[model samples]
Target: MSWNPAQYLRFADARLRPALDLLARIGGDTQPRRIVDLGCGTGNVTRLLLERWPAAAIVGVDSDAAMLACAGSTPSAIGWQLADIASWRAGFSPDLLFSNAALHWLPDHDRLLPELVGQLSPDGILAVQMPANFAEPAHRILRQLAGESPWRDALGAVRMGSILPPADYEQLLRPLCHRLDLWETTYWQVLSGADPIIEWMKGTTLVPFLQRLDDSAAGHFLAAYRERLAAVHPAGPDGTTLFPFKRLFFVARR
Candidate 1:
């Protein structure tokens, strides 16, 4: 799916909170010599890594050229690589492998997570955070709309792949990790707009559905989705919408 950096950043502060939370939990004794930010969209979170470990050599890896282009230049010390996160390998075993809001795009964490763990140094750290808000109305509305008429035919298998429960992640990583910190947080974000929920999903969840439809059909889908969302997540007295977004976070040190 194509990503629009501008659209994704519409709620930048809200989207960035989980990344900051994930970074805060990654602790170790030795200073990292090398770090990699997998699926570093627009280098926003990657820039935080540079700030935290200015001495370390950091690389930002992403698949989209447009998003990478928006990332622009970094210091000579930081490397920007264009590659798929699923198959991308670091030239050196990194001291820290960080991915924020990226891994969920790929399915099958059962196999994928272990492959990433193997790429780490013996004592390396793997830090990740991803949206676990699939059950929320914003996403539920999309699934409901996708099941209807033209959308159903055009957007086959529109639902997200299975995202394992929180306990499942702990079970999967416990054997491989010496130290593991896993938790979930629900952020009550207050957004202001005509249809804030729809605006928010347009950046991420709505992209795939929109991609399959032409302009007219896409508009119809959005209208139907908006009506459904407004009923579920109506604006408050102050004209702000409270969007409860849940996210999963984990940090494993091998």
Candidate 2:
């Protein structure tokens, strides 16, 4: 199953806020002839790029058909393809490689980033944003809780990848590109209702956990998760839950 965009309302149009910030810093008059979104999940990022560069030919690629289906609904002008970046090829060298909340799934971006840059035109740009809250209490406690569950035997080996250390990312991409911008920020998301936290995660971190189990185990997982979350994520003074989320933003122009 692909990620359901409806489940990730927190990252819906709200994604544009951060996406614009990243793009603005990497601003230029070099209009791209082509653009590609590496893991175009549901095309929110893809659509944003299109809105910014309507003249550019844009393509969104993902490994999941379900995700591509949702992306296809945006417009016939945007090309959505089902393919893995590891082996995927760009029909034409893109002037900009844009990715959001994607790329941590990639194992060796340090080595891979240069290769992707090589796919760019003489002077292309690469902009990416990824959630980097693996160290946060929310993800930490959830993983620990899952490890203790009976179903851990099957899912225990799954380890989420890091979105590169801030320095490591700069070190890897700075030399290859003419300009590089890298930083991280925490968005204090005020979610209404005691249960919105679960809804927020279903579109992301909770996905793998739930996919590991059958219907029964998945229900148990969510129930246990909610119980743990309810204890840690106490309601704020406004009677809403505040999930302080963090993400890393990086842009390198070659």
Candidate 3:
């Protein structure tokens, strides 16, 4: 799916919060010499890695050229690579394999999670965070609308894949990891502006479905999706919408 860096970064503060929270879990005593930010879109989080360990070699890997271009614009010592995160392999074992809000895009986590852990160096860390809000109204409304009459033909087979339960992730990584930590957080993301929920979805969840329709169809779909969302996530008296989002996080050591 195509990405718009501008749209994606509209709520930069909210998006950055999760990345920072995940980063804080990486113990200060552990200083990685080589770090790979897998699915490091626009280098927002990769730059944070650089600040924490300026001496460490960091590479931001992403599949989209437009996103990478935006990431490469700023002068920095970090490396930006354009490649698919699912099949992409590191030339050398990295001390830290970090991905934020990216791995959920790929299928078959049962195989993918362990493979990533195997690629780490001895005692290397694999820290990741992904959206666990699939059941939330923002996404549920989209799926409901897509399955309806007019939109059914184009979105019927739209398989965005599934995010396995936390227990399943523990089962997959426990054998390979010497130490593993898993937790979930629900952030009441207060968003402002008309159709704030729709704006937020446009950055990530709305991409795939929108890509399948023409301008007119896409517009109508968004309108319907927006109407449904407003009822479920009504704005507060101050006009800010409280969008409760859940995210899953894990830190594993090889």
Per-candidate TM equals 0.96, 0.92, 0.98
Q: Tell me the lDDT of model 3 at 139.
A: 79
Go through the candidates in order and give each one's C-alpha lDDT: 0.87, 0.79, 0.92
Residue 195 lDDT in model 2? 79
List candidate 2 segments past 4 Å from native.
9-11
The residue ranges of model 1 lying beyond 4 angstroms of the native Cα positions read 28-30, 73-76, 159-162
Alpha carbon deviation, residue 19, candidate 1 (Å): 0.5
Q: Tell how far residue 92 is off in model 1, in angstroms.
A: 1.8
Q: Sort by TM-score, best first: what order?
A: 3, 1, 2
Report the lDDT tens digits of candidate 1 across residue range 111-208: 99998998899989999998999888787777877887877898768755346799999999999999999999999999998788888888888888
How much is 240 displaced in model 3, in angstroms? 0.8
Of the two candidates 1 and 3, the one with more favorable lDDT, higher being better, is 3
Q: Write the per-residue lDDT of candidate 3 for residues 1-254, one digit (tens) a residue.
A: 88999999999999999999999998989999999999989999999999999999999999999999999999999999999988989989999999999999999899888889889999999999999999887878788899998999999778654589999999999999989989999999999998898888889888889899999999999988878888989999999999999999999999
Every model: Cα RMSD to truth: 1.4, 1.8, 0.8
**Ranking according to lDDT, highest score first:** 3, 1, 2
